[model samples]
Structures are given as structure tokens and as C-alpha cells.
Target: MGKPVLIIISGHPATGKTTFGKMISEELKIPLVSPDGIKEILWDNIGWKHDFTEWSNVGKVSFELMYYFIETCLAQGKSLVAEAHFHPEINNARLNALKDKYGCKLLQVHCKADKSVIEERFRQRMASDNFHPGHRHGIVEVYGEEKFYDKLGKGEKLLNIDGEVYEVDTTNAENIDSNKVLEFIKSNL
Candidate 1:
């Protein structure tokens, strides 16, 4: 009924991005585009091998699907929330182009946590057999604890999207303040 808004939930691993994204998706009634979710589907289809290099192909295909969904949602004038780490090395031009074409507002929610807390959660996730395969591998084990911490510490900065941005620190708590995230989305909507 109105212009679609692209709510991007982004941050370092284990920072509660997915949790916040799910809440926003429910509250706003928009679809969630999560690469991690795609990776899990890939795992279900191809099976998880517990191999170190499994994330590479999975990530590629997952993002391909993600972009397709993004384009479709924007084209059809449907608001959506996309979840991802949004690392600095990642490009934003594609999303920007879509925004310019669709006249959609890009609302950013940046999740964060303390370094030690992130390390503990990441290690715990890596050790969990039931965790998403893409979430479990490489982030902590392959990069090692030091590099992983460093990466999370120097996490990505926000892009210059033409909308408001919200930050949540979920270091000590299991629950994020979803109400605040929802309020932000509603305000923008």
C-alpha cells in the first residue's frame, strides 16, 4: 500500500542479528532474507559433511538466492528484512541500485556484543552439532580465536543508506529488545 522499506539486520556473528530479524519480520509482517537460513536449506539438501571448506559454495549459492529475493521483493513493492553479517568487504551497490530504482527506504539495524561474549557464544556455536552448518564452521575454528575476535572487534561500519539506523547491544542478555526494533521499523513505515 505504501513504499516498501528494506530493513537490513546486520552485524558480526553471534550478535543476535537473526533473533532481531525474526522479531522485526513478525512485527512488520515482512519476509526475512537470511543467507544463514539458505545455507541450512543447502545443508538439508546436500548434507553437512563437517568439512572445513563447506561454507564456500554454500555461501555463494545462498547469497545468489538472497539477492534474487531482494530484487523480487523490491520489484513487487513488498517490504522485507534481510539478515547478514554485512562485513566491510561486502559491497552495497546492488542494494543501492535497487533502492534508487524502487524508491524504498533502507533501514539498518546494527547488532553488537562485547568481544569476550561474542567469543564464548561463537565457540559454543562451533562446538554445537545442532547449529547451522554455515554458522558453525570457519568463523571460530578456521580463523582461530584471535582472528575471530579481531574480526568481530573491528566489525563492519554501516553503509550510507537513505534511512534511519538502530543499534542493539546483546552481549549479556539472551533476549534482544525487539520492541525497540519494531518501533524503529514502524516509525519508518
Candidate 2:
């Protein structure tokens, strides 16, 4: 058996993290744990409000659930891919601790795109009917354009951790080759 691997798909919002992470998870045959996925479930079951505070609280719960799932998988010696807009100050320590405790190989795939492209993508997603209402309310209605973009601009870097980092240019998501990403993971693991 090989070492358990934790593939972290991280970046600012609307950088194609979810789409790319899904590809990695499918190719690697590992579970994909994402906060937004959990949050959607929580919204469906427990309900959500259009207010910022309610959205923020639900988001925190989603992260907690995501970490619980990650810890459980690692404890069982299973590999998984976790996708999120992870902040260094909030998530780096916890992720590093998990890596050390479980002796898992950590690989961070940080997606990047031009600011303008990201902004446009985010706007489109927010406007889409399929997008979760909680997100549209929290990000667009509450945070507004300026604050949201400012936060996104600040989070364009990787988490502070000891790991193999692979950066993907997602300015054009169609240009991303999943096979190459899988090759990188295979070589690292």
C-alpha cells in the first residue's frame, strides 16, 4: 500500500477550483470534500437566511464538517481531495497538523487566473439560477463588489505549509489538462 495522499485544491473564489478538484478526485478515485458542498446540504436541511451573519455562521459549520470528514478519512488510511477557498491564518495550522499526524503526503494545487477574469466568472456564477442563494446573498448582496474583489485579490497565494505545490493557470479553464495534473500527483505520491 502507498501513503495516503491529501490533495488540497485551493484558490480565490471562481478560479475553477471545484471543477478541477472534481477531475482530480475522479481520476484518483478519491473522495472530494468541499465546504460549499456541505454548506449546500446544510442549507437544504437546516435552512439559510439572506443575512450576512447567518451565511457566515453556516459557512463556519460547513468548514467544521469538512474537517471532520477529512480527519475521519485520514484516520481510516484513505486518501481524499479537499477543495476550498482556504485562508492561511484560519486553515494552515489545522491542515499541517493533520498531515503530520497521519503521515499523509500533502499536495496543494493552487489555481490562478487574472483578476478581471475571476471577477467576471464570479459575477456570472452569482447571477446563475443554479448557484446557491446563500452564496449570492452573502457574497454579492452583503459584501458588495468592492469588498468581495478585495478579499479575492488578497487570497491569490498558497497556504503556508510544507508540501509539494502545483500551480495551475485557470484563466482559461478549458486549457487545463487533467491528465497532466494526474501525472504530477502520481509522481509525487
Candidate 3:
């Protein structure tokens, strides 16, 4: 089988990673695998009684399920787009290892947005029913708004990747140009 393409759309919360992933998935016509989406499903299926305190455990399971999905896709010679707020130190290494194991072409899309814009978007999401429980009920519930903002203010430090990277700035949400990102992925593929 030919090597598959694995596109990673990653960034801090509210940076529009999911939106980018969706656009890329549609353009590439491949599955979109989201750890947060998987976590939501796990929360709904496993119940949220331990969500706040056991979120790490829940996240671990969700990541496991995500990799399972990736492995299945690789075995089928199917490409995929995965969206997440990946930890630079850890998840990047894992992704690299997976690329080696599956011989898949890896393209990383790093997303960023203005802090104030991200915070506003985050607040709006928290007020909405669509807010991820893992964020609203887990992280925010434990850290509170003030602390959450403090950490977010420090900002996310992205790790370096070996291959091509496309940076997308979504500060002006109305002006996000997904075509650029798609073109980069298609060119890399």
C-alpha cells in the first residue's frame, strides 16, 4: 500500500484548529480525527462523575482511542487530519514515532490567534451548549477563569517539527483563508 498522509492541525484553545481540520478533511476527502471530540464521546459514554478530578485519566483513554483510530486508518492506507491542542514536548514525539511506524507523510499545521480574541471566543464557547465539557467542566472547573486566563496569557510554546509546517493566524476570524492551508497540504502530499 502507498504511504498515507497525516495532517496535524494543532494549537491552543479557540485558535480554530477544528475548523482548519474540517476544511482540510473536506479538501483531502479523508477522515478527521479529533482527540477533543473523542474525549467528549468518552465523557458521554463513561459519565462525567469523575471528569474534573479524573480528567487526566479520561484524556489518556481518549488519546489511546485516537491512536487506535489512526492505526486503523494507516492500515487501510487512508489519510487523515487530526485536530488537537497537542503538548509540544510529548505529543510531537508520539506523532513523529507514528509517522515513522506507518511511513506516512506528516504535515503539521500550527494555528495561532490574538490572546484577547482567543479569550473572547473561549468565554463565548463556555456559555454555549457546544462547549467541550473537558474544557468547561474539567480544566476551567478546576482552574477557574482567572487562573485559566493567567496560563493562557503565558501562551503556548510550539515545538519544532522536522517537515513542512503551515502557520494560520485566525485572529480575524472572518478572514481565515483556508485555501492557503489546503494548498500547502496538497503540495506536501
Maximum-TM-score candidate:
2
How far off is residue 48 in model 1, in Å?
Answer: 3.4
Per-candidate TM-score against the hidden true structure: 0.85, 0.93, 0.90
lDDT of 3 by residue, 1-189 (tens): 257988888888888888888888887789999888888888788775563458778777777888899889987888998787788887878888877887887889988988888888888888999775656777556556788876662456464555688888889977877888878888888
Q: Kindly report which residue pairs in candidate 3 clash with one another.
A: none
- What do the candidate models score in CA lDDT, each in turn? 0.78, 0.85, 0.80
Highest lDDT model number: 2
lDDT per residue for candidate 1 within 1-189, as digits (tens), equals 389888898788888888888988887678999988988888788775544566566777788899899889999899999998665456477667778998988889988888788878877777888786545454545445566667664645565566688988888685666787778778878
lDDT of 2 by residue, 53-93 (tens): 77788889899999999999999999999999998888889
Q: Which residue pairs does candidate 2 place in steric collision? A: none
User: On a 0 to 100 scale, what is the lDDT of residue 102 in model 2?
Assistant: 97
What TM-score number comes out for model 3?
Answer: 0.90
* Candidate 3 Cα lDDT to native: 0.80
| Model 1 Cα shift for residue 67 (angstroms) | 1.0
